[model samples]
Target chain A: MTRVVLVPGALALLPEYASQVDPVAELRAAALAAVRWLGPEAAVLGDTQGERVAAALMGAAGVRRGGTAAYLVVGNGSAKRSEKAPGHLDERSFGFDAALGDALVAGDLSGVDWSLADELWASVDGLRRASPLVSGSAAVDYADDPYGVQYWVMRWGS
Target chain B: MTLRLGRHEFDDDRTLMMAIVNRTPDSFYDKGATWAEDKAFDRVAQVVDEGAEMVDIGGIKAAPGEEIDEVEEKRRVVDFVARIRAAYPSLVISVDTWRASVGDAVCEAGADVLNDAWGGADPALVDVAAKHDVALICTHTGGAVPRTRPYRVEYDDVVRSAIDDTVAYAERALAAGVARESLVIDPAHDFGKNTFHSLEITRRLGEMVATGWPVLVSLSNKDFVGESLDLPVGERLTGTLAATAVCALAGARIYRVHEVVETRQVVDMVNTIVGRRLPARAIRGLQ
Candidate 1:
């Protein structure tokens, strides 16, 4: 089975921008655990900013990119889930994130509404890129949008 | 350079709050608020709860009043220091006295730093600090006697004079066997300094920080803050915190303050802006 891990592209996870208290502490812990379980080598899939978040998480988890069938996907849901959210409240964010999160946990990325994710500011390009091979069931270690930006830490495969 | 304040040790980059707990009946700010022993003890508990890393226990008011001799000053601070030590073992206990007898008595009672606000009035105070293996606050007072207000005390270059006098005092403390890391220099604002001198010191505090010795600032509700804003003691908190932000930017390590929470916020915010410290919990757009 192909090992796969999914984590949100939160800039707070990077050591350079860290605060004294971890704001994304639980999310970071879950991300690290899943990444560590991904073993020493895996293919990293994400956008430009997501790639940076992936690299930081990999370095922190002592995992690295190498030639392997396993995949580490970096992406997130909407930034407009509330009035205080970065993109402000967008009513479409609710239905969009609901469908997206369900698709991720079920490892069925083919149904992701790419155009709607872009409109809602959801980062799903990496998951979109891995859609063809994403077939196994996922175990969610984390799932929440504390800052109004939906984040999930899920692992797929044995 | 880790700070060694008697039994406690702090990291080099850490900025500390040294809350002032006056035991004087006529001190300008509190005006005998904590004159009684139990009231003073309550003040200690309050500052410690408010996150003050140190407490500067002063028995005598800064301005001239009734003369408090060695025996009287010792009587005022020695037991208070011992009681605070027994309660808060981790707290840095500093006794604000210019008398060697008071310093020795407080050190015997478990004091940490000797904050000589009179610019080394008692030369033997250094020896007392050395004898106790504690920290010493080397302050620059322009040769003013203890408890005397500044009267037309002019300086050719106030910052230069502050640097030279404070560094010289620090060296003197070093020669008297005080540990180099244990010595902190302060440009004692309003102590033998006019409003202009204090303002200049606050403006060019980086010169004092450039001397490589950790700087301690006692800008809490002082006359300079009052005179600058034309406000009374009760109205000088904003002014004091303004001066505090400047000193913190210039890399002052310890703050002797009356309002612990406000000063801590100002120092932490200023240090965070200057990159010396991190934000307590930043998660605005980075989430």
Candidate 2:
């Protein structure tokens, strides 16, 4: 399955799109929802636009400082129609996530170099074998096109 | 019979919207639709339903440097045109080709117009178009016919060069027995132009209108837009709409575009501006 690793602090809270513009609040909500899908052991952390937050989030997401796995650096950016947190991400970090939606969902960890990006993507074939984030039924279909993948993580039953 | 291509009307107000159906296997967009009879026919119906007055079917990719083998080109053209002909018997079909052999097959298969990029440099194509009694849109981009002198940005005469090339193409069509009115002329906007020259010609499109026949202005998503707006092809829609508005204001009878809905709106708005000078009408009526 494709591996999608998201580092916190990559997200922004922009008021321009305020169905509700509160990032911390939305992250809390997302955390609550993800636990339903990923189980209670799944830790939820938000990525602020700061570097320290990025490093901590990347570490928490299991992205070693210098490894390659498909990374979906989710932060404040609009899909153009909805509220997205705003913070500048270098183009590759932003673009790769947007291009390959499937890879971000599958969490494919191989072929990715995490050090090259504050955020990036790779296929972690082993993670699928070990992690409950993807179930046996889900593992078969997790790897997706690796072009541009930015995903909101939900580890399999927590 | 009076004919209309799209929004620009002739005798019958039914403007023929000639949807450009490129069946090139490597077309920039919609490449997979080529040679697949079902997909190609579906595209034909889609464009026609989208209010295309006619469908311009082609086998070769128009983007620079891509060439199709003459035999395969002819076969694809014939097969697609014949199918469209059989399906929409009353539809006005224009064959997009500079190649004489392919042009011959489609024309013989009941294509109504010959839209040539080279302006009849191929004498045989002109003869084919003439024999088929089809209307011809003679177009010239600067590159299609090499300039003995490198194209100068400083034109001692912009209108003369545009009209001269168009007139020459019209003369060739006339010599081939195409009716004078049936020949439409376009100022091949980006085909051989620097920005200033292109803008200059566009600003003075009336000079082309002065040539007496109808004018077809095709500034759709061309280099001029990309260079000016610094936008890729997909993002050139707004720029395309602006150029179409300018072309319509300058009296271009037909506008070739990828974004049909917006192009139609811009032209209709321009037509409204031309049809009734609203401010003047409003002032006089109020007075």
Candidate 3:
């Protein structure tokens, strides 16, 4: 079976950046559960900051990095969804995120408009690389933008 | 070392606020304000609400005043200790007295600590603390008599003298069967020392803390703060909190204070700044 899990590259998930009262507790819980489900050892696919978040989540779940059929990808949707978002309000953010979320759930990245994603501040490089191998419906664990930045925890297995 | 205050125990890193509740009609601060039993009880309630971990109930004023004998001292504090004990079961109750008889009575009435603010005037006070298995606050007053003002009391080396005297008193308490964890040493501020001496003690409080006995500092609007900033009792809170920050940095375990909320904030802030404590909920830019 080929398993793939996607989590947000949230800096808040890193132990060094942790606060006494966690701001992304629900997101962190969902991410950890999805990552742990990927198995004891797996390959991580992400950009520089995404790799750091992947390593931290791996460490927290006590999962080692090694060659495996399972894959963990760190990515998130637009950061300009609302006025309080990291990139501030953008009229195209909601539509861009809705398209991204649909693509992730359908296991297809052919419809992801790269230019619009860049304008919306979306992290989808690793998602695009792993899209060909993705198939079947995703078991969505989390999808929210509590801090104005869209995030989702979804898993695809074949 | 963990601190054991009678029925209550605290971890090593914990700092405690011991609020002063005066029952006398002529105490220096808040004179006669809590003289009535109900007013004193209200004061206790207020401090508790303000997050005081302990309350030091005093029957007699520290200064020389109309003579209050052992019988009168017990009359004022014993029943009050019992009442506070029944009211706040988890609050640590400390009695400020140098008399062995009063120590015994308050301990019997559920007092957890005997704050001998007069530097152990009654030698048998330690025995009473040991007999009741309560904590003892051993203080150094430069050998001054109880209730008497300091007159030309000069020390060859004030900090050294404070460490030696307080350590010796702490050892005596240990020898008298008081649990080592229940023994605390204090440099009695403004009790027998002049302003300069008190300031020096506050500056070099770490030496006393290094003695390996949990050090308690009673620096709440005392004469030393008044003299340092040329401010009177009502206006010395800032100076007092400044000195409190110095002591908190030096690792003082307990603070005997007048204003519970203010002193607690100062101590906690200082500890957090020095990396000894964490911010309550630090989420600033990390989120």
Which one is best on lDDT?
1
DockQ of candidate 3 relative to the true structure: 0.44
lDDT of 3 by residue, A1-158 (tens): 78999998878888766655778889999999999998888788888889999999999998888876889998898888878778889988888889889988988777778787778888887787778767878999999998778899999995
**Model 3 chain B: lowest-lDDT 10 consecutive positions:** B278-287
Query: In model 2 chain B, which range of ten residues has the least summed lDDT?
Result: B278-287
What shift in Å separates residue B249 of candidate 2 from its native position after superposition? 1.0
Candidate 2 ranges with C-alpha deviation above 4 Å: A1-158, B1-9, B12-16, B29-35, B143-156, B276-287
How does candidate 3 fare on TM-score? 0.93
The TM-score leader among the candidates is 1
Better of 1 and 3 by lDDT: 1
Sorted by lDDT (best first), the order is 1, 3, 2
RMSD of each: 1.6, 19.9, 2.2
Residue-wise C-alpha lDDT for candidate 2, range B125-241, written one tens digit per residue: 777767777778878565354222225545566667778877888788789887665778878776566766777778888878777767877777776787789997668888878
| After superposition, candidate 1 runs with Cα above 4 Å error | none
lDDT by residue (B50-76, candidate 3, tens digit) is: 999999999999898899999999989
Candidate 1, residue B175: lDDT: 97
